[model samples]
Target: MTDTLALAGRLLLAALMFAGTAQKLASPTEAQALLALASLPPWLIWPAALFTAIAGIGLALGLATRPLAILAAAYCVVTSTFHVLMDDPWQMTIAFKNWVIAGGYLLLAAHGPGRFALRRD
Candidate 1:
């Protein structure tokens, strides 16, 4: 039951990562705009997409679970900066959401990947 729940949580987070990556690829305009707003290079979308894909797959496969979760949490905090700098209420909400997601990742990191993981540690 514990392993199952851990796998479920990992899968959910993986889905989020894949969905975000897909959105970036399918329609990059908004992401690019956000990059511009943050004074970051628009071309960063490609690397970001790649990172998400790799991290998502890693999470799904339960590979290097703790490290990946920690990295994902850091990624969330870093990305949230774009939304944090915005003056709009909606953007602020997004930033808060990112932080919450980061917290989840942190918990996952602390919990390990359970017995269902491909590489447990």
Candidate 2:
């Protein structure tokens, strides 16, 4: 049951990451605009999207679970800063959500991916 729960958690987190990646890909304009507003290079969206895709895949497969979870957590925290910069109140909510998600990733890092992982550690 622990393993099942861990698997479910990992999959749900992966889905969330994948959704963000898809959103970035489907409409680069919004992301690029955000980057511009943040005084970051707009081309950064490419690498950011790629990293998100890799993170999602890793989470889904439970590969390098601990290290990946840590990295994902850091990613979440960093991205939250961007969301915080948005003018919309809803975006601030999203920023807080990102921080909450980061906490989940940190917990996953501590607990590992359980027995269902491709490479449990």
lDDT per residue, candidate 2, 84-107, as tens digits? 855699989989999999999999
Q: What TM-score would every model get versus the actual structure?
A: 0.95, 0.96
Clashing pairs in 2: none
CA lDDT of every candidate: 0.92, 0.91
lDDT of 1 by residue, 36-63 (tens): 9878899999999998999899999999
- In candidate 2, where is summed lDDT lowest over 10 consecutive residues? 78-87
What TM-score number comes out for model 2? 0.96
Model 1 misplacement above 4 A: none
